[model samples]
Target: MNETLIRWLEEREIADVRSRNLELAKAFAMVVKSTDQVFDLGCGTMSNFRYLDPLLSMNQNWIGVDHDPGMLRRSEPLVPRTRVQLREMNLATGVRTLPQGPGCAFTASAFLDLVSKEWIDQFAAHCKDSPILIAMSTAGQPEWSPIHELDEPIRLRIKSHQNSDHGFGPSLGADAACYLVDQLRHYGCRVIVRETNWILDSRDGTLLSMMIDGIERRVQSVQDPVDAQVWADRRRLELLKAELRLTVRHLDLLSIP
Candidate 1:
């Protein structure tokens, strides 16, 4: 993966902290214990590690897995007091190789939405008996303040793009969290879900700008260039004037057997 993407993942952690559901984290923490092994899927640079390490029991072992060696290498320095072992693996197919059963937990942050339904089914079966916390899967279209007519059209384009293959075949995209919840329940796991929306304002200019740029890229192929540029420019102007507010809805899931 590119260094820029890794840096974005690191920076995004700040926003995610504010968005993460505390009650759901506490509930998941109650089931974990010292010395339990946790596998963090798609753990880019271990931002999830920093967020989860303190919440989990002391001395818990973590296996941070990602396909990118650069990200795993980047995660090395971020390790605080927890014992972390980084692994390079393609989670789309390698999830079945993860350990299961007692004294283990499964977790992933902002990952479920990128994977296909088949991959999720395999994941649900693998973690059926273990406690799992999957957080920050996008729930729906973002809410933008000072809404514009182009907002709806751009949003629809983004949705269409999200359903395309994201390295795991057809992505569940915005529907991932709900599908995972249903799948977990079918396996007899008690599941809890909470909103973890990213509410960005003027102070979040850099992150918000990056988000807008991403949206522009996603909509470029399907949306008219003139309309897309107009929308992007308007958003930039709003950010510059400190009048922009964006609420990106996400869901956090905690499942216990």
Candidate 2:
């Protein structure tokens, strides 16, 4: 499949399985008035908006920021009832440029892991009074059912790769949500953290396969290509046999003033 198509499919799959913290969301909804401005960072194909729009006040004004024009374009049609202004701005260098105020809230999905500690600090400082509900940040390494020997090695390599610069200086990777919580609390904002793990089985074959392929792509350059291929092949076979299960831990964070 084309990489872009794969991303869209993966985003859809994630939306279906995402475990949002409803209590926190409700609180955030209460904090944000119908007239408040909402900012969705790294909005991608608007999965965050599709999930959050119904929870927020109707006719709320929104700004969806992303680095990719293609993603922004695709996101526009996803929420017909909502009023969203899409901007193709890279979050790395542009986060500080976003205006924050009393009647505003910030949101992002599957985005915190890609940013650096400095970036988070800057963002947290700027949006100190604004309610923030960031979702789906990787919490730790994934677990595979019927363990394989190569799992540990591949996981380590993938973790290392994840921490590498992804446009934002060194990425915080699995530590992002934790660090953000600390940062928000430092700024006197009440923070809530919740686990939203993705539990994939045979029923999620396509997502599982794509995840395996994604892992292989990340680890192959650092480890032996043959080993990466072998591991991926075995996982695919297990998927076909209905013996594969995967658990990827993630965190959902909410910050309230």
lDDT of 2 at 88: 89
Against the true structure, whose TM-score is highest?
1
Scored by lDDT, model 2 comes in at 0.83
Tens digits of per-residue lDDT for model 1 on 132-238? 99999988988899899999988888887777788998999999999999999999999999999999998888889888888887687764533577899999999
Deviation from native of the Cα of residue 158 in model 2, angstroms: 0.6
Q: Give candidate 1 regions above 4 Å deviation.
A: 80-82, 222-226
Residue 94 error, candidate 2, Å? 1.1
Q: In candidate 2, how many Å is residue 192 off?
A: 0.8
Best by lDDT: 1
How close is every model to the real structure, measured as TM-score?
0.95, 0.93
All predictions: root-mean-square deviation over Cα?
1.6, 2.0
Residue pairs whose backbone atoms clash in candidate 2: none
